[model samples]
Structure formats: structure tokens, C-alpha cells
Target: MSFSSFDRKKENSPQPSQWKLLRQELLKYLECFLMAVINGCQVSAPPNRTAAMWEDFITCLKHQDLVSSAALETQSCYLLTKTAVSRPLFLILDDNFYYQSMRYEVYQLARKYSLGFCQLFLDCSLETCLQRNGQRPQALPAETIHLMEGKIEKPNPEKNAWEHNSLIIPSTTCSSEASLKLTDLLLTALENPVTYIEDNVEQKKADRIICSTNVLHQADQMLRRIVSQTMKEAKDEQVLPFNLKLLAEELNKLKAEFLEDLKHGNKKYLCSQETVHIPDIISFFHYEKDNIVRKYFSKPH
Candidate 1:
């Protein structure tokens, strides 16, 4: 139930049966691929050290107070299951999830309803929740630590290796790159006390002269550079759910209005409109900077 090169059949007109079969196969691939990766994270490998890795992991997660424990667990499982990375969806979802905040009630609600209306129902009415996960129990000081002081038996490496292999799953290459970036950033931040995240504000690189974060509307004004990039890429690839022709038609109408305004001295009206040109003035660079182009027409279309 996978698409192959052979399926790119000539299309004078696709028969209804053919369309149905193609859609079914696509649905199966989406479901199987999604489930395989999501399910892969319930890894069975016991940590090499006798101590519970979840304790250390949970401790590390707390510093990222940006994320909730339960949500983090879900994302961790997603990554574990999606052992091998490859696909555009991986970047979109993985990136979005990385920025999410998690909660224990989110987990409880998930169990109670299994995400049926978590977003539409439960989460819609929810206000920001802050739960103080108390400090992690400190491990005995490093100076007195012993490798195997506890009479605990060592974990089975053979079993772990088997589970590791069994746990390996395929994903888009971009997923691996993104995962590594996130991991490296977190690791670097933990390893260095002075590390500061670039302000999420809409400051262009050059605009960040002194790394001043005192800009007017700080947190609420934070720009999503990731979403912006995703949108640009999606537009370039024609993957956005948009009606291009309709959009162009609308723009042309807008341009006509702008032209009419410009014909007179309408410069005092709106700052945005002052620089606008005829809708047909600019051609589409897959529709990325149409608004910008409207402002400054560099060699009209």
C-alpha cells in the first residue's frame, strides 16, 4: 500500500475507481507511517546505570519550564518512535511540538478522552496553567559517587541493543537535522550559564544591534520565525492550502484600487497604500513578497 513511480500515470481523465484506490493507498501510508513513528517511542531499553533515566530526564525537562512534563513525554515518545527521520511533515509537527508547553492534566485528559477534543474542547477554554514541579532530588555529591556501589545489577546491554534496533524507525532526513539542532541548543544552554536565547522578537539580524530585548511589546509581540520560514517554503513548493488564481484576482483588484488612488495624490492616506502599485505591477515569486513588491515595484511585471 505504497505509492511507486509507476503510479504517475498519464491523466487524460482519471477514472473514479483509480482515484479512490489512490486516495486509499495514500491514507494507509499516512496512517501506517504516522503510527509506526509515534508507537516507536515506548522504548524498552533499560538505562545502563541502575538509576531511573526518567528522573534525570524529568529534571532536565523542568529547566525548560516552557514545556510541561506530560507534553514533553509525548514528544519524547514521538522522537523515540520516529528513530529514523526523513519527510516534510516531520519538520512542521516536530518543530511546532518542540515549542509547546505540557501539563499533567493534559496527560490525564488525554487518557480520559484520548485527544478527541483536547484542542477544540478542553484546551479552548483553558487559561495558562503554571504547575510548580518541585526541585529534583539531588543525586549524592559527585565526590562520593560510586560506579556500582548499590548492590543493583547492571542492565542487560544485549536486551537494550535488541530494543534499540527494534526501536529504530524511518523518518525524513530533515527531522534528524531539526532534532539535532534542538538537542544541541539545549545541551549548549545547559553546559553554559551565559547562553541567552535570541529574543523571539521580530528583530532582523542586523536590527539586533546590542541584543536589546527592551522593545515595546516584548513577549506578546514575539514573532514566529519558524512559522514564517515554513510559510515561505510551503508557498515556494505550492503546498499551502490557497487558491492562487483567486488570490491573484483579488490582488489585481487591490492593485487597481491602488492605481486609482495613486493617479490622484493619495499619498497622505495610508502608509501602506502610499507605496502600492497596480496588482499586475509585480509578478509572483511564488507569491512570497507580493505586498512588499506592491510597495516597491522593481521592474513592473
Candidate 2:
């Protein structure tokens, strides 16, 4: 039977599918801009028709609260222009993109912007796809799936270096697991040399902050150890009750000086080395303690 006949016989139902839910989850997980061609199964159509479908999909996304209702022209321009500054972007095109010419255009765009590009092919068997399609409220005619199967082309790494990072996800996997797997794959792809350079700068800054915090913690420990030792020695000799107030004031001054030095110290030197020189830190504290001891003992009281 013809697809038109099949369509006429069935009631028009707009119930959402599992694929829709998966798409929503991906969008939320990425929290980034997206551009997709959301068309139902159809035979080959004119390029203009495809463009119209894209516009309709954008409208539907807004209605479903999936995206904002920003001006279409400005939004497209903004997404393209600020691709680097934005969190991340995902542009999903139909699997029917079999032509090398079409793939080349996409490759050029990714290359121009130094963006990582990966093609994810849903590798499902013909029977499996047909079975799933049969369960849909707006099921495509069996013949349509058959036609698509013949026309579909798998990604080739050697032939297309730009799309070398392609992934093939099997349809047999559970929906939730598949979504997670795809998420991980995309994250890994983001680390490709072409894209990692942009992300590495932020990572380096975070590392520096952690390293600086560790240095401050070490300084704090060194000061506390020195103060504790001095008080214990004074107590052993029963010397003026070990002057708790004086110990605290001296420790605070030493900490302030140490922190000042750390602030101006070579950050690269600190982070590259595995351990700070504990002996050097101890020596500095010992010198400070001697001055405190001398001044305290000199007082006649």
C-alpha cells in the first residue's frame, strides 16, 4: 500500500515518543544551544522544504518550552558568532546526509571555528527500526524505512579526516544507558586536540587555585607546630606560665609574613614540585621563636 493510503487510514496522533524524551534529556544535560531538523519520515523533498521544516521545528520547540522565543535571525547569528564563548553547541542533522559534498560543508564550518565535530550514526538493524516504527502513533510506512536503509551511508574515517571522530551507537542498548553512553562520547570528543586547547586554559586556572590553597595550609601547620613546641619547652622549665598571649601574637605575625612571601613567590615553582621544603619552613619558625624567647626572658617582670 502507498504511504498516503496508510496515512489516511490512521488517526492523527501527536503522542510523544521515547526518542523525544531522550532528546529532551540530552538538551538538559548539555545545557547548550541546539539546532535540529525535526521532520517526520518523508520521501526526498526540495531543500527549501527542508528549510521550512527547520523553521517549524523551532516554533514547536518554543511552544514545548524547549527553547526561548528569540528572534530567529538574531538567534541564529548569535549562536554562530559566539560559538566559542557559549557553553557548547549541538547541531543535529538527519541521517539522510549521505553526500560527501554535504558532509564537506559541515566539516568546513567546524574547521573554520576550530570546533570539535563528531558524527554519531545510530547503528540499528533494518528489522529493529521497522519494528520500533510500527509501534509509533505516527508510524511511517514500511516502504519508507526500506528506502532510507538503502540510501543511508556509514561514516568513513579514512575518506573523511574531518569526521574521524565518528561514533556508532547500537540500538539494542537500553534507552537510558544509550543516552548516558552518548553523553560520555560527546564529552570525550570535546577533549580532542582541536577543542581541548580552549578548555585547558580554564583547567589550568583551577589547578593554580588548588595549589595556592595547599601552600597556605602548609604554612598554617608550620606556624602551629612552632608555637606548640615553644610553649611546651617554657612549661618544662616553669618559665612565667609559658605566656599564652605572647605566643599567639608572635604566631600571628609569623603567619602574616609567611603569607606575604607566598603571595609573591613563583607559582610555577610551587605547583611543579611535589613537596614543599619542610626543613626550610621549620628553620624559619625556629628563628622567629628564638627572638620571642629572648625578649620574654629579658623582661624583669
Candidate 3:
């Protein structure tokens, strides 16, 4: 019988078998996923120095909040532009913070003056954030003066040496991926053994968060690539850096403690390479193609 034959006023009218076959075909593409485990949860800044920065920056903002929005915008503008600000003002925002606003503000300010390269580093920040503001570095600690040059897709060995330095936004996120970034001995040394062990438990759970997280990251990357590619092919000036970077930032957004642990390098995760057997999606859903629509109502989305 045709689907139109269903009785009038019947929301649960029988569905055509063809509709079920189409529905099952759609589910196949949605199941594939990827995953990675991690260990450690270290922040770029040492705990002591980071705490101090938090205290001081909050105090600075408190004064601005006391004034009206119009007045504050004037002050924020002066701080952002007019005054000859010193090199490298670190703006730290946690995963919970909506930092796209910060990015837009910085991008706008950069337009007026050649601010060198504009960069957003996830997982890591510049080294100076940990250093005392006035004291000179002992032996000129390595600085972020240039981009990690070379091909965008291939590995570049000379990345550490490129000169003609300008704006280096060194981020801990782009460095050593997977287990490499987490569990630095420096951070482990700072931890009290008992609390450290407890943190490890939550970290495992994070690593276990269903493949949904990875799916979201992959979707975002795919969208970014399509966007970047479309823009670049037409010679557009502004093409966003997509892929690992876009994925990295979203990964940091997972509210799960494991993600936080992975971001800051607190909880250590075991990383072992393994092969996968994707679900028998097609066969499983197509058990009986003739009556597929019946299965659609019986099964879940």
C-alpha cells in the first residue's frame, strides 16, 4: 500500500518500507569515530606565578568595572591601542571562557598597526608569563620570535631556527600531542602523591568519554578545511588555520575533568596504538530491507 493510504488523523500511520531503508542508509555514515588517550595536566605557567597573575589581573579589572561601560571602553581601548604597550601581553582564559570575543577584539586592534603575526595558542602560552615582569631572564631564555615556519602540512626540521622574528605566539597545545604534552616531570614533582592518584581516576574517565567528542572535533575540522580551502582558492586574504588547531581548542572545551587534566597535564593517560573494526553498520541495519520502516520505529535514532 502507498504511504498516502494511511488513515487520516493517524500520527502513527504505517511508514513505507522504502523510508526505513533510507533511514538505515543514513545511520551508516554517522557511526565512524576516532579516539586518543593522554596523561598529565600541566599548565604553561608554574602554579605560583600563575596564581600571582590571576590575583593581579583581577585587581586591574576590578578598577575598570567600577566605572561605566562607556568609560571602561575608553580605558580598554587605551590599554589595547593608543599607549605604546610593551611587547607580549598575555591574555589567559580558561576552557569555560568564550574566548572568540577576545580573538575578535585582538584581530580588530591588530588591523590598525602591523602587529606582526596574529596567533592563538591553545594548551600553551608564552614563557614570559611565568617569569617575573621586571627581572631579566637568566641566560636569555628561548623566546617566541617567529612562526614555526615550513610547509603547513609537512614536518619542518628548521622550524626552531627561522629568524626575522616578529610576533611569536608559542602555545603548549600545538607542541607534543597525545601523551607527549602531559605528565611533564616538573608538574608531577609539584603534586602531592595522594591527590595525584585521585586525579588519575577522573582522567581515565575523560579518556573514555564516548567517541562523540572526537566526532565533534572531526566535524569542526572538516568544516574549517572546506571554508579555508574555498577562501584560499579564490585568493582571500583571511583564511583561518583549521584542523589540529581548531580541534585542539574544542578538545580543551570538554568540561570533563579528564579533558582539563589532559589540557593542563595533571592526569596521565595510557596511549597505545590499536587497529579498529568499524561497526557492521550496513548489515546490522539492513537485516530485513523489505520491512525496514518497521525497524525504524522500533529502533532508536
Candidate 4:
């Protein structure tokens, strides 16, 4: 199922936190709907507390001609199927998820149900996005697009392990190859959903050990940027394609090793506060990367 951001309109603009709350609520409804369908239920209804929000969301869908008017008369908020059959369901969430955190929320939801999770990042230019937005009958303000352009975060697999299943498709490159790649990505995700053992009360206490992962996440993003810049520099220096490939492999291996060390609480890299010394870690990474690059370039070609 898909929910378009443009279709959802409000008389008053919602603050960032309010928008977050609304998104969470809608996703909750989506989870409920999925559960109902999976259980072979005929009808799905919103909880009593958030019934009004569901009504508003349904109204928005109807206004956009996405749903039939007959849906309004139904006592059940949504009708999944007349007689549900036991079958796999593929859900596609199409939206402009500008923030990484926004997309991560959905990934978390998928993980909760052990469902497939993959995302397609439409790498469109701001100019093109604005042009298309203008062509719409109910066009959004140009300023809103500008604002979103500034806030948008494209998927970076190097930084986020969860986003590794994602594909970044340029706006102009919607070829058959891209379509096939997307199909493959979906199939792979379906075959291999996020796997993790459920945590009990005792295990939850040990969760504190992994709390530093949040810091590591930020560090990973920064480290990837550094590696990317370094590779670009190497390319500019006319590094051979063979050497470039080797360079990338070495850098990625180093990154994995570094991350593993951080995961295991390597005391050498931690500060007095038990937080990661990011600058020190980054410095060590740069040192290792530079050494690796030198080794690749020391000999001829």
C-alpha cells in the first residue's frame, strides 16, 4: 500500500515533532492492516484512540481518488479481501522520506514483523522535482520543495547496514535494467529479512553494551565520506582501474575491522566516558587507508 505525502493536507502546518507522531500513527495502522491480512481477516479497523486520524487518512486517500467512495460507508476502516487466502503479500511504501530517521522507522517496523525491507531512492535533482511539482493540479509551494531538498538524505549503504538492501536510481535512468535490478532487490529482501533474536528482560539489560552503536553509526557515516573523498582523489591522480578496485577492497576491509573493534568495546579507542573517541578512530582509519594506498601505488601500475 502507498501513501503519498502530497495527498495528505492539513489546514495548519504540523511541526516536526507533530509530523513524526502522525507518521508513527499511520505506520501503526499499516502494521495493524498487515496483521489482519496475514491472519486472513476480512476487515481491519483502527483502534478507538486513533480512529479520527485513520478517518482523516482515509479521507485524504478518497480525495486523491486512490480509494473507492464505498469505503466511507464501511464500518470496518478498511476491507482487505472478501475471503482471505493464505498467500504472501508484497507491500510497497511510496513516499518522499527526506530524513534517514524517517526511513529507519519503517525499517524497524519491517524488522518487528520479520518482513522484507528494501527502499528505492529516487535521485532526482531539485530543479526537476520542482518542475514536476509545478505541473501537478494541486501543486505544493516551491519553497516546500526547496526545504525538502535541503533536508533530504539519500541512502548510503556504506554508512548504514540496514540500508544495504536499498538502490539509488537516478530520476532519468528508469530503464529495463533498473526495473530488473529493483525486482532482484525485492526478491533478495523477501528471501532474507532482517534477522535478530528477540530480547528478553535479562537480555535487555545487556542492550546497554550496544548503546554506543548510535555513536558508531555517526562515525560510520563520517568515515564513509572520508573514504569516498580519498577514492575520488586517487581517481583524479590517474590511479589504474585495477589498483582502484584493490584500493576499495582494502578500505572496506579496514572499515569492517574497525567497526568490529568498536562493537567489541576496544578500550584503546574509547574515552573516559566509555564513548567512542571518534577523532582518534578517524585518525587511525586515515593512517591505515593512506598506508594501503601507498602500497597499491608503490609499484608500477
Candidate 5:
């Protein structure tokens, strides 16, 4: 019943530009699936490599052109469509997701849709990660592991109020106690979907930007920081060594694009208040970076 055989790591995962679309379609599919479960559909056993009760769900996604016809025949598709005989459905997204912005994207989705959101941080020591990596048939470069060690941003619940539902456990811990705690975590998340909370920090940032004498200078500085942070995040996520140069080129390209849009007064890039918001541009830059990552590199090296 394990989905290990058909995880997203082996598939052409969604690109950044498609992320919003994917999230919307997934929400729709979840609603259909929940309705089906409530209607007492003939659910399959352990839901392993079967999609008998998921026709409606699959059709819903297919009609949106999210999954191709060929993809439907794959084990990954079946795994995605598989359902539990319970009320709540959990769709697990497994990845390195090294950047906070990357994880924040998912958090925003959960908040917007009022879905459950929780983070499980596996605090595996660098030594352990390197050891296990060495044992693998296709071990990643030691340097890559070292790079990730320095770049990984552990869950900081205190710093981030929204991350209050996070749990951190040692990677090696596999006791019944851990399992029970995990079960509780999931239950708690399912019971309490994330609610929209005003971000005072963001509000303050916007106010400062608005009142600044040199708004363009402030924006340029922020954009530079965004680029620098994005490059670091890319490295932290262990982008394939061969694609690092391409990733950089792509990021710079996006920066130029944004600069042009800002300079020439692109209406789409302008806010309703008739002023350019650096945060919006930065967010769009991250989205572009995600697209570049998915297009150039499937997974971390």
C-alpha cells in the first residue's frame, strides 16, 4: 500500500507557473472525492495501485489538463487517486523543499483553501545524512550534502507564527510513541485548517516602503536581496551541479524582466493603488524561479 514506488520524484512534477492551477484543481478534486466518500462509494482495499472508486476524481483532474492520458496508466496516477475508507483525505507531497519560500507557497495554499497544514521536520544529523547517502546505489556528491547542511532552514515556530503546528523529530526515531505523536499531529491539522491571519510585519514593510523618499532605490535593494537569497536557496535545495549555471542565468533573466516591467510601468505588474509593490514583484520572482527549477531540474542532486 506504500506509494514509494510512484512518488513525484520520478515524475515531471508541476512547474512554478502551474502551481496555482495545480492547487486549484487539487482542491476541486478533493471536494469531489470527499463527496464520493460521504456517498458510500465502493472503496478499494488499502487503496494500493487501484483507481476503481476514483474515476470521478481522475476525470476531474484530467478535464483540467493537469494529468495526461498516458500519466493515467501509471502507478503514480493510481497512487494519487487512491483513497482511504475514512472521511479525511491526506495528499502527501514529499520533497526536499529546502527554501522557506517554497514551503510558504504550500502554506499559502492551505490558508487560502482553508485546508489543514502541518510540517514534519526530520532533524537528521549531517553525519547521518552523509552516511545514508553513501550507502545508496546512486549517492549524491559529498559536496552537495555539505552545501545542503549549511543551507537547510529548520522549522522556527517562534520566528514564524504560522508554523505553530510544526513537529520536529530525529530522522532515526521510529518508535510507537513517535507514530502516535504523528497521528495526533495529522488529526489536529485535519480538525483545524489554517485561517487567514494579518501579517503585521508585511504591513509594516509596505508602510515603510510607501513612506520612503527613495522608493526605487529601496526596491532595487530588495530585488538584489531576493536574487541573492534565491541563489542560496537553489544551492541549499541541491540543484543538479550541471544546471546551476542555467539556474543562475534564468534567475538573472527574470530579474531583468522584472526591472523592465517596473521601469516601463507594466500595468499587470502595478498594484491597484498605482504604486509598485516590491513584495509582489519578489513573490513573482520566486514563482518564476520555481518554474525554472522544475523545467531544468526534476529533483535535487
Candidate 6:
């Protein structure tokens, strides 16, 4: 049957206690999205020798182009069929899947199969990751961790178009808490998959605001450094007629020019979106400038 017809049938079908049903159904399929980490950063390994050996074999085979390609195709078909027979469940693959750029193709598969796709990155510092690797029974080489660190591309919701539902879990997060958080995020993503595009736009807007704020802060710091250095040089040289009033006027002129330059340079980003208040940003700078003037210029030289 066509997807549209199937969707129509689904829409017409009676679903009692939809949320409860969904939650229970999802719990059953949770294993689908619980991807294993084979990047030498796993905090624990399976105690079973056979399981560990199998995992190691899979990891090694994944490095071979022909084997990996065949494996991915087989896995995709299995996942697609499983999803078709039941509610959409998370498909958890290893980090190596993302490194190989197969995650994008998987994402496409999810869309084609009408499955919800989200990526959860278990974020850990290099030191922490390496330390964890050391604790494993079959410890991976430090060089392996280093190689994966350089090769693995972390998912970004704002930048990666396919990673609209991506989330980063910090190393400090407890397992239970992380599981709960992942479940919540996945449920939300599944329920609102169509909104991913809109969510991405909002994410970009937030990113732009943060970048602009950082630029303003850097500019303020630059101004303070310049003023302080100029005053110190003047004091050392014993320049005549150098006073607070003269310094204030010079600093004000510099601030005005800097503000003008900022306004002109970031006109596109600043003016394009009305999400951020330009006046509020300007006021913050004004307050900072006044504070700097009061603190430094008030002192007798």
C-alpha cells in the first residue's frame, strides 16, 4: 500500500490511551536505539566472552569497506521491516556508523520507512574517555582513541541537517538520568518529527544570538584593554594636560566608532532576525562602558 493510504488508515484507526500505549510500546523497542559505543570509550563491556568476541569481530569488520557496506544494507533492511510492522523505534548504531557518513543514509532510510530518527552523542572529554578505555578488560590502544577522536564528527542540530534531533549527553550525567533524558527526548522527537525543520531554524536563530553576544563582549574587552594601555603609556611618558575629561572624551569617541563598525559589519545577521533585541545589546554595552569609565577614569592620575 502507498504511504499516504497507510497514513490515512492509521489516522482513522481507534487508539485508546495513545500516550500510555505509545510509552509501553516504546519501552519494548528501546533496544533498537540503544546503540553500542565501539570507539574504545565504553565504560563497561559485556562479561560474556562470546558477546565480547562478537562485538570485537563486528568492530573489526566495520573497518573493511566491502564488509561494512554489506552489513549496513542488511541492517537497514531488517530495521525498515521491523519499523513497518510496529511503531517507529530508535535505531542505535555504533559511533563508527556516523564516522563513515552512513548515518546520513540511515537517516534517509528512516524517513523513507516513516521512522523517527534522533542521535544521542555521549560526550566525554578525551582524558575521561581514555581513562574509561583503560578500565576495560581488553583495553584498546591509546592510539585507537586518538584516531577515533580525529575521525568522529560530533552531531550538531544547528549545523547538520540530518541531525535535527541530535543531543549531547555530558560525561558527568548518571546512567539512569541519561536514560530518562534520552527517552524523553526520543519521545518528543517521535511525536513531533515534522517540526524538525522549524526546530532547526530556531536553533540557528539562537546560535546567531549567542555569536552576536560573544562578539559584543569581545569588543567591550578590546575597548577596555586599549583604553587602559593608552592611559598607562601616557602616564609613563608624563604627557601634559592628560586628565579624566580628556580620557573620557577619547574613549567615548572610540566606543562610538566601534559601535558603528559593529552595526555596519553585522548588519545582515543583526537586522535579518527580530528575535534578539538590538537595543538591549546596545544598553548592555552602554552600561559596561559607564562602569569601566567610573571604575578607571575616576581615579586621580
Best candidate (score: lDDT) = 4
Which 10 consecutive residues of model 2 have the lowest summed lDDT? Answer: 1-10
Kindly give the stretch of ten consecutive residues in candidate 6 with the minimal lDDT sum. Answer: 1-10
Q: TM-scores across all candidates?
A: 0.15, 0.38, 0.17, 0.59, 0.47, 0.36
Over 212-277, each residue of candidate 4 has an lDDT whose tens digit, in order, gives: 646677678888988898788788888989989988899888888888878777654344545556
lDDT of each: 0.31, 0.53, 0.28, 0.72, 0.62, 0.51
List residue ranges in candidate 3 displaced over 4 A: 1-105, 112-117, 120-294, 298-301
210-253: candidate 1 lDDT, tens digit per residue: 12222211211222232244345445656335544444444445
Off by over 4 Å in 6: 1-88, 98-100, 175-177, 193-301
Higher-ranked by TM-score: 2 or 3? 2
Q: What tens digits encode model 5's per-residue C-alpha lDDT throughout 129-207?
A: 9999999986878998999898787777775666778888999999999999899989999999987665878535434
| Predicted model with the maximum TM-score | 4
Candidate number with the higher lDDT (4 or 6): 4
Clash tally, candidates in order: 12, 0, 14, 0, 0, 0
TM-score of 3: 0.17
lDDT of 2 by residue, 1-301 (tens): 0001111232553343443343333233222232221221111222332343344444444443445544554534111222222455454544345444444445544544555666777788999989999999878889988988886768777644555677777868668877887887677666662443335555454445446556665777777776777666656646664476676577667666766666566433245554556566566667666777776554321
Question: Which should have the higher lDDT, number 3 or number 6?
Answer: 6
Candidate number that wins on TM-score, 1 or 6: 6
TM-score-wise, the better of 4 and 6 is: 4
Against the true structure, what is every candidate's RMSD?
A: 25.1, 25.3, 27.5, 13.3, 14.3, 18.2
